[model samples]
Target: MADEVSDAGTVRADAWIWSVRLTKTRSQAASACRAGHVRVNGERVKPAHAVKAGDEIRVFHAGRERVVVVSKIVRKRVGPPVAATCFVDNTPPPPPREFVAPVAVRDRGTGRPTKRDRREMERLQGLGGDGPTAR
Candidate 1:
């Protein structure tokens, strides 16, 4: 909105990130900046850093990284539809999740495993050397 613009035609980094919907809250954006997770033009930035149209911003958050080029600047949070026009997303698709093997579980009443059982379980988990050698 016109009220969200500054005379310099730029907005604070955290505010812009929130306004564009890159983050759920401006505080989170600030924390990310403080943690060195927000970059502008490939250089780390602070929460108060000024961001203008055409700057490339990279944010690492929620276990994923987002790469976006600023298309517009707004200081007030906008709806998703309007927010989408505020940046050009260049983030790659998330990596596929690998299948994790199920962990071994004993019965509820089972007692502590014996040394042999421990060794066998360790072998199954690939944590120890090969199994018992031939006699």
Candidate 2:
């Protein structure tokens, strides 16, 4: 039935995510849920999990976590303006890029790196020496 599909009061987690533009596509939202990248109220949920207003949702994507509190339920994808009002974003700002050290660059015509140069570069990358310790 139409009411069964739309639910009127609640929406599927993946549908809600895509409808609100949290992800680029509905399929991506479903994939995220299946990969354990989505959680509702601190519990991991599948794509079909019901999402309602006031529920807190956390989505991990693109190396960042997006925390949002649902304020509205929508089943159909909407424009950005409308999507913006569906959730209250609670995610912290990403860390500054300046904190990352610059990578070593070789000049043109420098040819291949010698063993010593490679070792030095590896050390600069913190992947040299003994490497990571075993668990």
Candidate 3:
């Protein structure tokens, strides 16, 4: 409803993020802000920071960074469709899975990796041949 939108023209950073579904919960948004994972206009912001329309916000969450421009101000959590209208997402697309290098996973109960295993893993990770003794 129209009443759900903030008439004050600004809302708390965490509340806006949560209302727009940028984060799963308001607490998560607040935690991210407290941890220096949220920014407004390129400066780190606290959870209580006031966010107005047109402000640029960057949030690091769930292993990815999200960049969005505030488009509308909503004080209460809204549906996904409504939330989508609240911000203009400018995040870059994620890299393709094929572009990601495979991580070396050692089996459990293997204790520690042997020297050769370490070397091999390093080689697979493209970190080989350039060590203190390589010369």
For each candidate, what TM-score against the reference? Answer: 0.74, 0.79, 0.86
Model 3 residue 107 distance off true place after TM-score fit, in angstroms: 2.4
Residue 126 deviation, candidate 3, in Å? 2.3
lDDT of 3 by residue, 1-135 (tens): 897764358899999999999899999999999999999999999999999999999999999999999988999999999888888999999999999998989999999998778887888899875689753
- Candidate 2 C-alpha error for residue 38, in Å: 0.3
Candidate numbers sorted by TM-score from highest down = 3, 2, 1
Each model's lDDT comes to 0.85, 0.85, 0.92
Best by TM-score: 3
lDDT of 2 by residue, 13-100 (tens): 9999988888998999999999999999999999999999899999998788999998878878877887787789999998899988
Candidate closer to the true structure by TM-score (higher is better), 1 or 3: 3
lDDT (Cα, 0-100) at 99 in candidate 1: 52
In candidate 3, clashing pairs total: 0
The better-scoring model by TM-score among 1 and 2 is 2
Would you list the clashing residue pairs of candidate 3?
none
Off by over 4 Å in 1: 5-8, 99-135
Decoy 2 TM-score against native:
0.79
